[model samples]
Target: MPSADPSTQPLKSAEELAQSRRRFPGESPQYRAARNALLKEEIELRRHIERVAAQRRALPPGGEIPEDYRFESESGPATLSQMFGEHDTLVTYNWMFGPKRQRSCPMCTSFLSALDGEMADILQRVAFAVIARSPVERLTAFKRERGWRHLRLYSSGGNTFNRDYADEDPDSGDNAGFNVFVRSNGIVRHFWGDEMGPETADPGQDPRGAPDAMPLWTVLDMTPGGRGTDWYPKLEYGAQSKTGT
Candidate 1:
């Protein structure tokens, strides 16, 4: 056979690359075959995720923030730059808990709940924070209720940070946004953000960002019964009483 140029050679199909032979006991041959087919699709999904991530990283520097917006932290007032701490990159989640609202958005709360657990691990690489439009006291109270200890919570009240960042609805004040900022050579600039909204949602699906950020949905997707349309996370679930009490 004539030697083929590596660059010109056609890439192997995902199905062709799936070579798993191990089988679980009691699994039918039909089941194994179906699983192998699904595995091939999963491999392609992983590759697509990597490709999109690379494109994100290669993006040109985003718009420079003109002002050092002020925010209320547990310690006191802090600037956007101050939020970065020792890291050049900062990830801030704009939670939908405006002062006027009695409760925060359940969806935002759900996302934050998962993030709370990973705060320590995520902070090791970059600065992370959860910002809300409510007053610091109110935000802290809810934080306590949620049992989130690691997430650095902040209040964007008394500032235009939320409005400037598109994290707050100008008229309604309800918001849920995830934004990233980067400081390079003493200049701060917007890095990325989750711009997807209800308008962008596909037919019969809720609007969600690519590479879903929450594990709840991801785990549910793996099961035979996928994330149900009617089910959603709640702030409080019904308590289970002690047996025989």
Candidate 2:
């Protein structure tokens, strides 16, 4: 169903809506007050997210792609237009698995691990793929090892797709990114992309984009300890790791 237009509908105060929720058992009045205030803020945050999405959707057509970037997929060479499949919209994640890296970045792998689970549901609406600098075989090898059954892994090693869309740098190597493209009226064009980077990061925070795509941090944020400053995902967690998988 389509979202109701805010301009056409009357709004409810977040405080009122928060209070409407059922209270937990054995919670103190002080706890309830703080919880209610937090809930109100969450509601506001949700509204802001929707507003931003609406603005994104309303944006004028983005620039046309410079070329039909070539990529190596499991079935062999495929063009950017072919990546869309039957859907008009295509979403791609820039995986940080360059040929030079011994192993893929744990952070990118972590996000892909989470994305793999939802690929089926997401593909039902739009085409999705993971683009990396590593060779297609290397990407598939890692996919098999990780048991990622749904992700469509591709290699941009032969083309400038990574350099153009994934922010590949000569000195810094592959950087993780998310890009959306659209096929319209026989023309493929660039759409929205997560432009947030280290330069955009706020003080004392990781350079994470708004509406964070990773469920790991989303779940962690609700905990008392939260996502700590030093803790990060590893390629392989040892048996002695404190956190449970």
Candidate 3:
């Protein structure tokens, strides 16, 4: 292969890159060859993710929010605009924990559990909040139960925010949704949302976004089992004593 800078030479197609002959220890020649081929595809997948993200960022202004939706936060009532403190961008994740449901969706809970750890880092760039249709007290209790300290939790119990934002399914009650909004010159406008659901899911695959928001699934994907279809996160795992049995 040429040693010149990659930019100086013609771009290598994914197919050409798959021809890498690198080898690893304790691996059969067949496995090494297959692994090298897979690496090229992974590289292309990364580039595609960046390309789609750029397209999303370049989207024209989305529909302006119809009203200043109200919500109940830890510090009393607040409006949509108030949620965006010092940033022009806001990301709201709608949790599927409705008043009528016994518990929140396991999938949503799993995703939020991971997000809670990253809330501080995520907030440095943009405002982030978690909204649920349950009463503030109920939501707060769950937050405490989960030991989520960084996620800013809010209640949409008395507002139409959930209904208007596709977070509440009229026929099925609560649903999980991720919405992004932008505030410019005192105007709040919808930016983007994860609209992919059962309708958009591919054959034999779950309905999920291109770049999954949950790290659990991503990590599991690299394993030999490849995210087994029968397994999913649970609210609580079997108890284990501190000391080894």
Candidate 4:
């Protein structure tokens, strides 16, 4: 049996598809027209996201890591290769819970809170871990407090893993980072890391990358206010945190 060529197939009209789905009662013609127009853009946005993902998948092999970074896990010491478990690919989030910080970055915590829910599903495919400069005990204690059972927390306090990959500046301190690595033929290599920062930021906009990673921001962006400038995630919504962890 021969399969149809997707590229050669005729495409459906976004406008028609958007309008055909559903219509609300008492919607005015002006509202419907505007809604339909926005829907078409949304369709294009989805297509663009696919294209970007495809491009990322097609990237050539990145530079090999200089050394096998060490980490302290709840179970004890682990190497970068050991972190991959049975999978060749590993996705790590560098948490901003350093020895100097009073508490973990609220923004990082929010992202992890959402990611924790999907950790099981994520691990079913690629290995996922949360790395922090804080001691393993400190990291695990916070994990227990947050009730995050699925996340694999490891301490990078004994190594330069954070300095190399997590944007750990000697003076400015640490910033949350997301990085991917791959192990091939018994060698580990850097795959990619989030590079968007203040230098790349657009005017009047916060420094963030496309297809925003945080669900909190994504959901807010869909609202009428569209992720207001003044607000941000907090460790405790209404309460003040102590000076140190």
lDDT, each prediction: 0.86, 0.89, 0.86, 0.87
State residue 150's C-alpha deviation in candidate 1, in Å: 0.6
Of models 2 and 3, which has the larger TM-score? 2
Each prediction's TM-score versus the true structure? 0.90, 0.93, 0.89, 0.92
The ten-residue window of minimal lDDT in model 1 covers: 236-245
Best by TM-score: 2
lDDT score at residue 178, model 2, on the 0-100 scale: 92
lDDT (Cα, tens digit) per residue for candidate 1, span 24-123: 9899989989989988999899879987998999989999997998988998999999999999999988888887888878788888889988999999
Tens-place lDDT digits, model 4, residues 53-164: 8898888999999999889998999999999999999999989888888888888888999999999899999999899888899999999988897999999888888889
Instruction: Give the per-residue lDDT of model 3 (tens digit) for 65-154.
Output: 999998999889988999999999999999988888887777888898899899889999999989988888998898898898888888
TM-score of 2: 0.93
Candidate 3: give the clashing pairs.
Answer: none
**Stronger candidate by lDDT (1 vs 2):** 2
Which lDDT value does model 3 have at 53?
A: 96
Q: Candidate 4 versus the native: TM-score? A: 0.92
The most accurate candidate by lDDT is: 2
Superposed Cα deviation of residue 194, candidate 1 (Å): 0.8
Candidate 2 ranges beyond 4 A from true positions: 1-7, 240-245
In candidate 2 the C-alpha lDDT for residue 184 amounts to 88
Clashing pairs in 4: none
Name the lDDT value of residue 50 in candidate 1: 86
Better of 3 and 4 by lDDT: 4
